[model samples]
Structure formats: structure tokens, C-alpha cells
Target: MAYSKLCITLLTVVIFMLAANPDVAVANEATDELQRQIDSLVRRIEELEKRAGQSLNVPPAMAATGAASAGNGALQIGLSGLFAGGGSSVDNDALSRLQGGAHDPNQNGFVVQNVELSIGATVDPYFDAKAHLIFQIDSDGETVVELEEAFFTTRSLPGGLQIKGGQYFTEFGRQNKRHPHSWSFVDQPVVLSRFFGGDGLRGQGARLSWLTPTDWYSELIVGLQNAKGETMTSFLNAPGEEIGGHTLLDRDARRFGDLLYTARWLNGFDLSDTISMNLGVSGLWGPNASGDNTDTRIVGTDWYMKWLPARTQRGFPFVSWHTEVLWRQYEAGDLGIADRETLRDWGMFTQALWGFKPGWVAGLRWEYATADGDTATDPLRDTRKRLSPNLTWYPTEYSKLRLQYSRDWTEHLVDGSADTLWLQVEFGIGSHAAHVF
Candidate 1:
């Protein structure tokens, strides 16, 4: 009789809990403790039923739960790397030296593209933190280590707002905010390399984001960052140097107004139960390295769309597409008595990926860039276009292999074109976070 009463009481409590919290059984990384307690109670109840010559059944929803981290602390460490080899026309080895290329070195032959290590943890109920370190080979053929990102983000803030501080990638465009390993292509687009620097726009900064109250997903973001560094291609206020007996930009002669400022508006919405799309607009402005206080401005638009079946087992027959267009204006000040010029340039790229089967994906991309002002002397600003097709196979969530082929065309340059074939291998270990959608 006592066991019967206990069982009845437990059932009543379970019903009440479910009624009060319908999501109590929702799977999450931090709910392992709750799941354990539930399992113990179910086991005891089953033992009681067996003794009473009765069988007890548990619902699958109550029996299955996600596993949490086994570590004592909240800290997590993850590592990812890419090694690539191929041949490029026009001897890209020389270009890679000048640009400090991101992702693949864009060089001939084999090279270790880069190795990245990430550490992250929740600081408390209100904050979380992350740090990323990158190791790569520099122009001098020396291995160099750099702190790519280290920032603290707010976990809870009023009015659907959040704040981030410290060094990080600025949300200037869709691709700038992504890590190299997450890129669809072997190298960054020509426009990104020419305007934002080969490494993608990033620096010490503070960012504030707000999720607007609406039926669809919408966000507004703004950031202020130090306008100095190799990544600061548009506003690289470097140290003073004598060029033809004239002083180049002097770092000491800088002002607060020279800081890089960025703003972006992003909107996302579902087209159907199985499809979604996102649209974004971004702008960046800052003073240029020309000590004369010349400035640079860039504006861009981005779009992304994805379609996947709702009840697919392995998420096959999926399609992902994205594109971005950028326009930039640069003022370099007077380099010569006869030259005081403002240059305009533009670039755009579109890509699509199709997952025809589980663990395999095929994609194609096209990119174009041109300088409206002049491309005669500046190879970086020259008119260029490329078409690339790639195939990727994933053995598991943590490892991937890819093969890509590209045909690059440069108008007005020696040889005017090149061909490249790239083989890339990537693997990740330890708690890795999902990439941004």
C-alpha cells in the first residue's frame, strides 16, 4: 500500500511539472543533471513495478536527453587546421608575400594554410568569453603567432540588447565575420582582399547589437574600432617613413576621429517551413593612412538563402546560396605634385552549394573586381574575375576534405589569366561551436 501511494504521488508530480513547463524535456548541453535525476526516478519506479508483478514503461521523450560537458570547469578548447597544395598561374608565390594571404597562401606547391586554436567559456550568469589564436607563415617564410580574437559578450541584457568588447572581427559584411575554415572557397574573394585587407577586417573594438521586436528576425549593429594595423587596409596609419625624401603617414600624428566606425542592418525571415532567407546592408568609414586626413568609405549589400526538408534524416538534398556586393572609395592624398586623386572600386561574388547526398556537397562560385579609377600600376586594384567549382566530403561532423579548381582572368596584366587546383583538408577536435547562420 505504501509503495502504491508513493507511485501515485510521483505520477501526480510529473504531470504537474509537465503542465507547468512543457519544455522541461528539451535537449540542451546543460540539462544533463536534470536528465540524470529523471532517469534515477524512472528506474526506481520500474523496480517497484517488477516487484509487484507489473511492468512499467517510460516514454522515449523522458528516456532520451542530451549529454553535457564532462569537464570540471565551463572552459572548452577546440583546434582546427587546413593544409592545401596546388599550382597557380603568374607565380602566386610572389603575390602571397605581398598580401599576407588569408586561408590558403595562394602560393604554388604545398603549404600549411593556417592552424587555429579556440578557447571559450561562460564567465558567469551575465557574461561569456572567447579567444582565438592563429598560427601561420608570414611573408618572410617565418612562422608567426597572432591573437585573432579575444572578446567578452553579454549573456543577458535588457531590451533585447547585447554588448561585446575587446578585439574581434567587425561585422562589416557577411564573410568578414567568419573564420577561414568556414569559408566555402579556398581563398577570400578578390574584393575582400583588396578593400578589407587579406586577413578580413578586424581590430580592437566595442560592438553593440539590438534585436528588434518584430515577427521576423532583424538586428542592428554598430562598432567602433582602432584604425591601425595590417588589416586596416583602408585606414592604415603606419609609422613615418621617407619615400622619395617625403614623410609617409606618421602614427604619432593621429586623432580620435581616425578610428574605424562600422554599422550594419540585418534581416532574416522564413519563406516556408523548409526555406529561409537573410538580407543585410553594411557601411564602413574611417580616415586613411595618408597623414593628410584623407578618408575611405565602403558600402555593401549581402543576401543568403537556404532550403532543406523539415523531416530529413541526414539533411540531404539541401541547397545553400549567398552573395555580396561592395563599392569603395579611397583618397590617398597627394603622392606627387601632379596627383591628388580619389579612387573608386567595386567587387562582387555569388556562390551556391548543393548537398546531393549525406556527407557530400558540391559548390560553384564566381567573383569579379574592378577599379573604376585606374588599374595600370596597382595590381591589387586591377580588373580580375574568377570561376571556381568545388567538391567536399565529410567523414563526420569534425572532419572534411575538399577539392577546388579555379580559372582566374586578369585583364590588362601580363599573361592575363591563370589556373589553379587546390586540395584542402580540415579537422577539428574538442568542443567546437556551430558557425553563424
Candidate 2:
């Protein structure tokens, strides 16, 4: 009996000693902390998988992290500022035409390219919403505020279908839907500026997208939007604008055919463990304000490919190529009018980027644009060619510095060509959504 009592007392003493031991307590706490961390990671992975299944493209590296950080039902707010300093061989007025893009830097000195505020959130199980507000300082030193995009997208739908509506960018091409802060180059593509106006094509609209059940990723998108705005450059632009020598009139949408109709079929393929590709064809048809019965049609194709090693660090040491070709047909006047004519124009741009190391990228772009007939004197329709090379360095995921040089060849320029150099800087704060692949 005495031995049994002594054994029990000794065991109790050992238990008390262990409970008081700092190392043991620390070990217990560490185990609990590890469990908590594992739970968090598991939750994040599940959320990411859910998003991947719903999204059209898989985001890379830091972008995925940003999306995950937003968490379910939480709002994400981000602000980004872009600034540029540059000089061009031509005067400011001529440079404006060369730059073409509303967001591009057009003057010889410092310019505030874009300041944007973005807010997004998952509204519920059925919907997600986002908005972007843009602020810029024009050459006249006037502050301009614009509602870039405000849209809602379906979160859950049957049969792999989704709908988006409200004021938004038309998904005419990969680049058209991207914001200025997401562009690889410091400026917008020359072809996009010419066809979609200084601002990329966007308007109040609704779109439906279907994610087909295929071995590889495939999606079909159809959209209907108002056709009469400055953003619809090839269609019913604002009054006083002239296209193909035909003055635009104040035209209203009298029928469903007067609205812009857009369609795109996009496909994605995993060519190999280390490479991926996306190919898409798009079309737009709508009424034009050039004449009472005239119309316009635009078609385009885009191809994108990226090569990464089976292993990557910070999504670095990769190569990507993107190309887009566009053609436009414009009916300039009434069929019975003496000056009636059918005008055709086409343009293409190709660009490649090499991420040689973490946060460092080198890029080159080539562009060519021309139209049928003797349009050499018309800045918008003339034969224009440009070559641009740029280098970018990202100090961190949220800040970057870039320098670019462009050589322009255009028939409308007095010098026949021009050289321009620009240095750009951008910084962002808060959680920004991941860019699409």
C-alpha cells in the first residue's frame, strides 16, 4: 500500500513539473500555433481552388496571393498612381496624335498618366462587384475624373454560365479589357488607340459568357452595348468627328441593330508542362453615324503564349508573346449618295517580353497600320509603323520603374519619322485583384 501511494505521488509530481516547465509549455503552444496555421493555409487553398474553377484564367504568383488575401465576403480596396516624363521629336500637338491614347503621356515634360482607385468585393453567393475610378491631369493642367468601370459579375451559375452587366470595358481583345496599370508597356497599343479610341472600347452593356465543358479551357462571350459614344470610335462616334472624310452626325439608336454587338470565342491550351497558349477571335457590328443607313464592322484575332520552366521563382525567368490583328470596314455615306464609298482599314501589333530575372523584364513591340486608298495624309488612316523597346524593374510587387523608346514612321509627319523617349513610374497600395493570365 505504501509503495502504491508513493508511486501515485511521484507521478503527480512529474505531471506538475511538466506543466510548470517552460519548454513543455512552449512546445504545446507551438503545436497549437502550427495547427492554426495549417487551418489557415487549408482555407486559403480551398478558396483559391473555388476561384480557379470559376475564373476563366488562372492567375500567377503574387496576383493569386492578392486575391486570396481579400478573403471571402471582404472588400478589397486599391489605389495606383502612374506618372511619366518624356520628350518627343515633334511638337506637343503632333505628339498628341502620335501617342493617340488618352492615358499616354503626350508632352515633353512630366505628366500624370493615371491615378486610379479600385474597389471590389464578393456581394454574396451569387454575385461579385467592382468599380474603378480614374483621375488624370491633362496637358492643360486640368484635373479630369472619369468612371472607368463599374460592373457586376455572377459568382455562381448553372451549366458553367456567367453574366456581367453595367458600365464596363468591351471584351473585344485581351488588351481592351485590361486597365492602364496592367499594361506591359508604358503606353497603349497603336492599333487599339486607332480603332477603339483614346480610351479602350467600353460602354453601358451586358454580356453573357459560357465556359464550355472541354478538355481544355474554352469560352464564348457575347455582348450588347450602346454604339454611340466616343469610346466606340469605329461605330457611332460623337457628332463633329469625321471618319473616311464623312462627318459624323448625332445618331440615336432607333433599333436593336443600332446597338453594338460583340462576340468572341477564346480557347486556352496547355501545350506542355512549361508552356501555355491562348487564342481568340472577335467580331463587332453596329450602325455608324456617317450616313442614315451606313454601318460598320470590325473583326480581330489575338494570340498569346507564355513559356515558364517547370519550376519558377516569383513567376520569373519566363517568356511571353502577344499579337493582335484587326480589320475594319466602314460605310462612309448613303448608298444613293454620289460620295458614297466603302472604306477599309487594318492594323496589327506584336510584342514579346522576357522576364530574365525576378522583377526585371525586357520587352519589344512592333506595330503597323494602314488603310486602302490614298490616305497617306490622314493621320488616323495613314500607313504608320512603330518600333518600341522597353526595360522594366520592379522594386517590389507593388512598385515599378520603366524606360521605353519608340521610333515612329508615319506618312503624315513632316519629318516622316520621330523618336520619343519616356520614363515611367508606378506604385500601388492595398489589395489589388490578380491580373488574368
Candidate 3:
């Protein structure tokens, strides 16, 4: 095993060395650094394995969830980081995770930044909990302190109700609920990116959810949050905040009731022990958006289905079809508009996920939107459409790497029309944070 390990390390070093220089002796600086880290991790794991065989010298790493395993559950700990920089036709949310990458000419370029460290425990009775410290890299190259998520839960909630608190996701959209690093592209869809902005926020409040008790698995969630709104540099120079650059209004600012609801169901038909067709519906609703106040509301929904067919003796092949719609309505959007009353927008997204290999999935997405009644500057007053092809590779249970390309075209605009071609690559890592809902 050690010999094989040596070979892997040596191989990576060789590749990087070759890329460095054509005449220089093979000296892989970057690869060497990475290999050393991986080798150290492997050595530690090997030592732990050997000790377990003879006598327990050290405790096993617990799973991030801290839930005792049906299969010798062990405590698991992990570390992760990412850097992304990319250019684009417009500054959207799709490339939210990647740090440095090429982009379009007309679009704005942003540095992808996030530093996360987390720890968790897996306890007996199928329960687990985790705590995370999230560091956000702002556009102005400033570091911000925020609590990402901290929660625990059982693998299977009997009554389908999973209760969670502390800072975590707000259940706005499937993508919103998940970390940005897990996305295929560096940016999110236009609607989501435009509507939600970034990080969104973890309402330091509470969340409740219920799952189906049937063979058809389904889950529903209701969350009440404590927010002043999104967090960022202040936007207003009013009496309260300091000199503001970018102000995030939707932190936990639910005057009437900052609430969110989400529901999803899966209908799986067994086609042999390992093959099946899984179908379902998912949706989310809440008061969200940059300008929306207590009386305003933003809601979203998704309808989807998937087919998993036995393609190879040792490989699984599957494809999914899904659509999502998001809408935002503001009660009074007039900072200074005439008879300013309501501003509403909703967009639709449909995509398919096809498993090309055991750990590789490739798919495409089509998004469209129609905005009704907006300030004279509403670019989407007519309608919008775009298509994106995304590919993803999950190397382990805890990490994923993705790339995507998209073309956006629109007729209506606040001023001139804009067309864009965008590309993105992203890597996601983190098995240490799990806030169950």
C-alpha cells in the first residue's frame, strides 16, 4: 500500500514538473506541496487503521453529523478552502465560489473567496451535530466574520419533523440552501443571483421540517428567523450605520414575520435492487429580496423527476428533469419613484442531470423569466432567456468539482441590449458542516 501511495505522489509531481519547464530538471513545486499534505493524511489514516486491528491507540474520527453508525460509526473531521477569480459579462451569482478564472469581456470580474473551518460529532442513536465558522471574502478584499451554520439531527426523523437552530440556511431555494461551492458554475442563474445577491444570510433563529412517512419520500420545512437583513457594508449614510459601501438589507429584517417554507417529495419505483425511477416536487417561499420590506414577499417552487437505469454491471446511470420558479414582490420600492408601490419578478429554470460516470454528471439548463411592472429601468420588462451546459465530478462523498458555460441574450433593458457568453469552474469541499433540516 505504501509503494502504491508513493507512486501516486510521484506521478502528480512529474506532471506539474513537466508543465513548469521543458529544459529544467523535473521539480514540481506546487504538486510537491500538495502531495506532501495528502501523503501526511494518508499516513495518519494508515496508522489509525493498524492500531484498530491490534489495540485501540487513538479514538476514531467521528462522522461530521456525530451520529453513531449502522456500520461502526466513527468521528470524522475535515478541513477545506477555495480561491476563485473570474470575468463575466455581468456580475451574477453563478461564479460565486470560484476564485480566479477567465470570463467575458463586457462582464465584471470578481474574486472568489471563502475560508471555512468546521468540526462535528456523530453520536449514537443515529444523531449527529456540527459547528462551523465561515469567513467571507468581500469584493473590496475585506474579511468579514459571520456564523455559517451549526446544527444536528438524526439520520431519519420519525415524525418527519427535524428541528434545527443556530445559524444556517433559510430554505429559499434548493441552490440557496446548499453552499455556493457545491454549484456547477461559478455564478448562479440570473434570477437567483440578481434576486438574492450573495451569502443571503443565516437567520440566527430556528427551523422546523417534516418528512414523509411513506415509501414515497417527502419533506416540508418552516423557518422563523431573526434578521436585520443581508449583511454587508452599509448602503445608506443615514443616522444609524456608518459610511456604507454595499448595504445588505435582508439580514433578519422580517418586521411582520421573517418566515420561509420549503417542501420536496421523491417517488422512487424499484426496478430491481439497485435500479429505479425517482420523481418529486420541491418548493420554497419567504419574504426575501434586496428591497422587500415586512409587507413584501418572495416565493419559489420546483417540479422535478429523475430516472436511474442499470447501465453497467458496476456503474449507475441516471438522468433528472427539474424546473424551478422564483418570484419577488416589494410593497413599496420607491426610494424616490412616482407613486412607488410594488415591484414583482419571477423566473423559471429547467435542467437535466445525466450521470456519465460513477462520479461524473453532465447536464444543461434553460432559464426564462418575465418581469411585470418595474421601475423604468427594469431590464427584464419584456422577457429573458438563456441556456447553460454544466458538468460536475464528485471525487469523494464530501467534495465536488464543476465547470459550466452559458450564453445569455436579452432584448429589453434599462438602456442598451446586452449579450454574453460566460464560463466557470468551481471546486467544493467540506464534510465537517452539516445543519440538518
Query: In terms of lDDT, which candidate is strongest?
Result: 2
In model 3, how large is the Cα lDDT of residue 219? 59
Which candidate has the top score in TM-score? 2
TM-score of each prediction: 0.79, 0.84, 0.63
User: Candidate 1, which segments miss by more than 4 Å at Cα?
Assistant: 1-73, 92-100, 139-141, 237-248, 252-254, 334-338
lDDT of 1 by residue, 1-437 (tens): 43334334444433333234433322222144333433454555445434433322444332221001324245765556565655565566544622335765566655557667777888988888999888765434566678899999999999999999999999977888889888887788888887877778999989999999988999999999998877777676355622112244755326677788899999999999999999999999887765466778999999999999886646788999999999988776655645556778899999999998898999999999888754654567778888999999877776677888888787655677777777666666445456567
- Which ten residues in a row are the worst by lDDT in model 2? 2-11
Q: Mind giving the per-residue lDDT tens digits that candidate 3 earns over 209-316?
A: 776577665556666655344421111112232111112243453343545444444345555654444444444444433334423456666555656664552244
Q: Would you list the C-alpha lDDT of every candidate in the order shown?
A: 0.71, 0.82, 0.48
Clashes of each: 0, 0, 47
lDDT of 1: 0.71
lDDT of 1 at 104: 56
Which regions of candidate 2 deviate over 4 angstroms? 1-68
Clashing pairs in 1: none
Off by over 4 Å in 3: 1-75, 89-110, 123-127, 154-158, 212-215, 231-294, 311-316, 333-338, 374-383, 393-401, 410-437
Please give the lDDT score at residue 82 for candidate 3: 38
Candidate 1 vs candidate 3: which has greater lDDT? 1
Candidate with more favorable, higher lDDT: 2 or 3: 2
